[model samples]
Target: MIEPPRFFSAADASIAVSHLFVRPDMLITLGFYKRKPGLSREQFSQHWREVRGPLIASNPILSKYLTRYVQHHCVPSNGWPNVGDLEYDGFSESWFDSLEARKEMHALPYFQSEMIADEHRFLDMKATRILMFDNQVVQVGRDYSAEIAAGKA
Candidate 1:
């Protein structure tokens, strides 16, 4: 079996994470979630798009740490059939300036209580998964970041 070449300390891993990725300007987190048992997809979607989105917007502490936030609703696709474990109801992508900033946001009282309960209303926390990474911009057909930020998009 293949094995690690050498032991890695947290500092070593942190340095690699910052420099190894193509995009280091921001750290992006993808939170994949499954609906709570007995909750319908429509109900989950409505609550996520309506209640959760607005809740985050209203919370200033969350906004302080989040540079960008987006939600992705899972849709049926013919290319790949949904299979067990691989199926997720939806996912959220949020960008933070640093790992410490994200951690601070999570530790806030408002996020720990109100946010946690709100998520529990429609999500099975046990089935939720989180992944963090930096992206590589391979190609862009359209550029809209500036326009969108300026409220012109």
Candidate 2:
């Protein structure tokens, strides 16, 4: 089971609060993938964005069930810490109105076969990971240091 984030009272350090609220009606799936062997990261990202993204967006059934879709491409940076040899090429997020909608979408033969087949072209299926959750936005800004320092956030 997925554990909810823990909340604590500022006045009492020992006090623990639970905020387990989630949008059960909606389902958001995040898919992380590493490019298939022998394929350059550029090739993988381009194919996903140019070909796969358009294909999914144009699908009538998929477009109907999917509420939102986003692609996150990883960029190499020297400042970031390197953890072992494992590297992720990118990730994609798909949001559905409900879990039932997602189930109905997958039940379609086109989604079950064609979509899966297309995914294999650029993605290393064995190295992919998928997580389902409801997204919660806490903050959105460039500067939150002041608020954090004052304990207002």
Candidate 3:
């Protein structure tokens, strides 16, 4: 018999959203920058909370369609310098306006050039779009058997 794949133990978080703005033929990308060594977690958290956090926070396009979920230890193999588990939630016709706005925002010199330049401290970086499915999709449930004097799956 085969066993289930082991999950990662260091998932930063997961942002699931419809790729409504990017062109149908163009791939919707998720950019992740690696954290440079000697960077403390607190410092890392603070930078996002104080700087980048506001940018993304203020973006009506992202706020409206993006859903951020906490994922602890979800990418064990993706070390500190790696960006793990980038995802796309497919497309939705209703998000066309938001998508257009996002494209325009990305085209901005401040975002495209400056921000891109500022994020080069990380170790590993990667990006991908959904052509097939992704990492395991697991569902949680109560282990009724444990309580009933039996067991589980």
- Order the candidates by lDDT, highest first: 1, 2, 3
Q: Which stretches of candidate 3 lie above 4 Å from their native place?
A: 1-33, 59-103, 121-153
When summed lDDT is taken over every stretch of 10 residues in candidate 2, the lowest stretch is 12-21
Model 2 earns a TM-score of 0.70
lDDT of 2 by residue, 86-151 (tens): 378987878887767777888889898989888999999999977665544233345454555576
Which residue ranges in model 2 land beyond 4 Å of their true spot? 1-24, 80-86, 139-153
Selected candidate, larger TM-score, 2 vs 3: 2
Tens-digit lDDT track of model 1 for 17-116 = 2212233556667788899999998999999999999989877778899988889988756576574434888988888877777879999989899889
Evaluation by TM-score, superior candidate among 1 and 3: 1
| Lowest lDDT block of 10, candidate 1 | 12-21
Query: Model 3 residue 57 lDDT?
Result: 56
Highest lDDT against the true fold, candidate? 1
lDDT of 3 at 6: 27
Model 1: how far is 85 from its true place, Å?
A: 11
- Candidate 1, pairs of clashing residues: none
* TM-score of model 1 vs. true structure: 0.70
How well does each candidate superpose onto the true structure, as a TM-score? Answer: 0.70, 0.70, 0.35
lDDT of all predictions = 0.74, 0.73, 0.37
